[model samples]
Target chain A: MHPAPSVIVFTVLSGLGFGLLSFLGLGLPQVTGWEAFFYFALAFALAVGGLVASTFHLGNPQRALKAFTQWKTSWLSREAWLSSLALVAMGLYAFAAVFLDISAGLLGWLGAALSVATVVATSMIYAQLMTVPRWNHWLTPLHLLTLSLAGGAILAQQSAVALALLVVAGIVQILHWVLGDRRFEERGHTIESATGLGDIGAARLFEPPHTGTNYLLKEMVHVVGRKHAQKLRVIAFVFMIVLPIAVLILLPQGIVSAALAILCYLIGTFASRWLFFAEAEHVVGLYYGARSAQAVAG
Target chain B: MTQLPETSEKKLGLVIDLDTCVGCHACVTACKGWNTENYGAPLSDMDAYGSNPSGTFLNRVHSYEVEPRAGGCSQTVHFPKSCLHCDDAPCVTVCPTGASYKRQEDGIVLVEEDACIGCGLCAWACPYGARELDLAAGVMKKCTLCVDRIYNENLPEEDRIPACVRTCPAGARHFGDLGDPSSEVSMLVAERGGFDLMPEQGTQPTNKYLPPRPKDQLPDMDVLSPALEPVAGEPKGFLKWLDKALEAI
Candidate 1:
């Protein structure tokens, strides 16, 4: 699920790229009509750069176009299609903004709509896996919103409207943590249900299937994951949520401090997203000689 | 180019009784012996006579302490899980190549070693963790239900079963045509109320397990070793002392 190093870099980099694009799209209409044109063009460039950067992550890059064919079922296909469409819409918005000097109406709304679609599609990639109960939570949608909003706020630090949105984004981040913590907390409970056991849970493996580590154990079982999860939760709660908001509240001056706040929030969100994927345990983990939650206490 | 005629309504499976299974690992050894020779490639054992040596074994006995749900007794059931020969297999459907296919005649999920590109998608899709890629063979390997022996005309009628079943010391494994309702396998399952492994997975596994009976009525482990009489035994040798020291460790 972590994929490869290339995949991790690709996903994280693309997340920042598209997230900033969505924010820029939303922020453009709020600022001066002339400024919207300039930002839209710049954002279009960023979107393409991000898109190309992500292609290096694919195992078979040539077969990637066929991924869109599975859109009727697979969220991955949907993400690919939506990402492409969103790119096209953003590009068209850029063309209209730069060429026709169009600052408002369908062009503006199209960019915003496409941005929203891309965010939803991106989150759906992990959220759609029925086997992975942790990713299938409501926190998925919130993370998507926070991702773009946090990045958009940074790009919008020159103005007060983006600054205000950034604060709202902080509140959203805090809310996500408050609600999202329960998902990780209640993972054991879900596994018990999935394993078809009653209240008599906390099943510890007396012994593993084999003495040495296999693919499942190496791939699925996170030996240091619980600690990583705990550390990341603290990071997300304090660095991502609390500290940024506190900085924004204490510093009343303007966008300079807002930039720092946005930066902290972005760093926090990235860690949060990484943990979100890493912490997600698939049901297949059970058969792979993965000991239940009691293995953690040991 | 295809000439194999498919027969409908055939249910083939390996019936294993938990009551008789001694967990002696005879079937495990037999499976390794047969598959390594007859299958696509030999199951290799690396680092022999060294720190670590490991090889593939299709049949593995999983001994678990299960408390009887209906009855009051609790005993250990040595569960041997392999390819279930499911009616609707998730592993088969998920395979991009037509390599992993269910035989319409017997409903046994078999890997076509020739067609198998070793993509490893089937292994990931299986909930039971049945399919394993034979790295040495450069293909997938699994329990074939003694495909070569079952249909072979040269083998004796009684010995037409899988080598694992034939070599089981405790007579734990049973092989037969499950299509016939009145077959010994079906009758035994009906009488004992045999259960499927991980029915929640919805593989609809053909294989069934006979639940473990009460442990209390069985002879206690404590009664096995009788108290040694205070006999003036012969002088203990160096070998005896070494054996005692090894046992203590």
Candidate 2:
């Protein structure tokens, strides 16, 4: 749970891009001509760029193609397949709208549904992890969906819906943190239970497995300080929620202010996403003495 | 392709005795030595001879201090951890490619390095912290349970077990068909109350760990403890004389 930059960028940018495409596929804002072309092109570029960035995090990027074949069991594979379907459908829709000057109705609806499905699949990738108790909740998918919609609504310049959804997204974010905070302790597995030594007395780690950091320690045992996390939460709230709502309400309704709100929301989402990974406590960490009396407050 | 089989034919696994392990780390070293040579990528080391040395290891021994209970002395428990090869392995299900899988024939979990994208999701899904992503090879690595050694017809029958089990100095490691009720390991489990590491996780791990028996009830504790009964006036006069004579001699 290192919160690698590639993943943060992938989720944020792709979420925004797909959000925009979803709205456009539904024929929102009633725009046409070069302006429509520009919007479609920008959305495509963002989605594709975010996806391309994802491969940089992989050790064997060349073998990523094989990931598409295991859809029966792997959510990652399902994401790959659904995203491909969404991209292809959106591409055809874009071509018809810009070049042929005719966006077919069936293709438009199919593209929109696929776009939404792609985002859902992406969310499922993290939500399905039972090892990370904080993420193993139904609210994870809701958080992803609402945030994407809020971002999407802002991009489409639908002032009323964006403002309303932004407020909802903020509340959902706070609720998610509150619930996730309690998940670790609610899970009964502790060092005593993990080692099956509770029948005896207290169990304390006398020696770690190694002197230096290994792969498991580096990847799974990420710990964030409570004070720092609180500060980051405040920052995320101000940018993701307060600033966007303020700008949309106080500032004039136009492209410039809307763009600023979107930027702030994106930054806020990035911070929250970072916390998502940083705060997750993998059950394996119990073996490494990660649990303490106050572990729940983390 | 990453979906698990409905059932494995032979649930071959290790039954480790926590009481006997001395934290010698012989199994750790032997596993690294055998695996790096035989069937998988080299257990690569980074900055090995430098200020901070780190490396990939399939098995690791963790020592814990357990507080005394029931008038017993505090004990050091050497816990050797690796892949449990669970029946419901999340690692296999989470693999995007078919690289990470549990063998249907023998219940051995393996990583097919050739097909691996090295995304490291399998490592994240495993609660036992068994899998390690090899930085140099750009693929995930784990305890194969020494599949090559265990199944190799070339090796002597006595040596046909995992390298860790073979190298344990205390003879604490037992490997056999856990599926068979009559197997030695199953009987040991039944007798000693062998348990999984984290039963709540619901991984249904094939491996079982025999808990260290309570020290207070140990049959030899009375013999080991010092006793103070004077030999001079034990039974009678003749015995006393004999005891004194023996002591003087």
For candidate 2, the per-residue lDDT at A127 reads 85
Chain B TM-score, model 1, reads 0.79
Number of the top TM-score candidate: 2
lDDT of 2 by residue, A94-165 (tens): 888887778667887888888888888888888898888888888888888788878888888888989998
Per-candidate local distance difference test: 0.61, 0.87
User: What TM-score would you give candidate 1 relative to the actual structure?
Assistant: 0.65
Indicate which candidate wins on DockQ: 2
Stretch of 10 with least lDDT, candidate 1 chain A: A195-204
Clash pairs detected, candidate 1: none
Off by over 4 Å in 1: A1-11, A24-66, A95-115, A156-204, A243-259, A284-298, B1-17, B20-61, B67-74, B82-190, B196-208, B216-249
For model 1, the DockQ equals 0.09
Q: Predicted chain A of model 1: TM-score relative to the true chain A?
A: 0.75
C-alpha lDDT (0 to 100) for residue A141 of candidate 1: 64
Tell me the tens digit of each residue's lDDT in model 2 across B12-73: 99999999999999999999999999887788998999998899999999988898665567
